[model samples]
Target: MITLLRSRRSIRKFTGQKISKDIQDLLIEAMLRSQSSRNIRPWEFIIVDDKKKLEHLSKAKQHGSGLIKGAALAVVVIADTNKSDVWVEDASIASIQLQLMADSLGLGSCWVQIRNRMATDELSSDQFVKQALEVPDNYSVESVISIGYPAESPKPHSKENLQYDKVKYGSFSKPFYQD
Candidate 1:
């Protein structure tokens, strides 16, 4: 698990290959098992594989969403705000779990933030995606994750690249002790 976490990378380029149904199921399972406040599990997902819809979603945000057009599949993460007060946090955790599961299965994924964002057409990202996908009014769009076979690989982040300066031991002036 640690190795998988260390090596996982956000991949924007895809080979355009289709993901198997088994892999999709695994991703969904991972999302469902993610931690949620009060165990309400208010998250909802929309799995989009349509090419035309993918193209339209690629324009959902002015930036950070071009990858959706080339992905084999895209999972739209939403949360039922009425069911959970901390819906966004819960949905975000689920999204990360889905991404990690994709990495473990040798697939690549990238998260495209949709909440409080805008599309190139000047519409709010959430509103545009809701209209395009016909999402229910009760749920709010949190993010869209693009998944596919990777066309390129990114080097994993290493301990050498970590910012030690930001880490505090007990108080602001104290440095972390390694023993």
Candidate 2:
């Protein structure tokens, strides 16, 4: 688990190769297994592989979302707002689960944040995506995870570069690690 964590990196560039159906099934399994508060299981997912739709969704945000156009698969993470008050957190967990599974299966993935962001000066990112995907009312978009074989490989983050200061022991002042 630690090795996988140490090696996983957000991959934005992907090859032209397409992901196989077997691999895609595994990713779905990973997401469905995600633990949620009170087991409400509020999260749901939409697998987008249509080229035209992927290109359209690439513009769902003003920035940080163009990678979807190149991904072999893009999973839109959404949740039923009426099912749980913590739907955002629930959907977020499923998103990462999908990404991590992709990483483990020798694929690369990038998380595209959608909630509270903008598609244009006048449109909210969530609304834009919901309209494009035909998501039902009362459901909220949380993220879109783009997955494919990596066209570019990024080095794993080194331990020394980790922000140890960001972690505190019990309180804000004391350091979690002793030098």
Among all candidates shown, the one with the greatest TM-score:
2
User: All candidates' lDDT scores?
Assistant: 0.92, 0.93
Model 1 lDDT at residue 105: 94
lDDT of 2: 0.93
Model 2 residue 46 lDDT score: 95
Lowest-sum lDDT 10-residue window in model 2: 170-179
Superposition error at 53 for model 2 (Å): 0.6
Cα lDDT tens digits, model 1, 85-109, are: 9999999999999999899999999
lDDT of 1 at 107: 96
Model 2 lDDT per residue over 60-176, tens place: 998999999999989999999999998888898889888888989999999999999999999999999999999997899999999999999899999999998888899888889
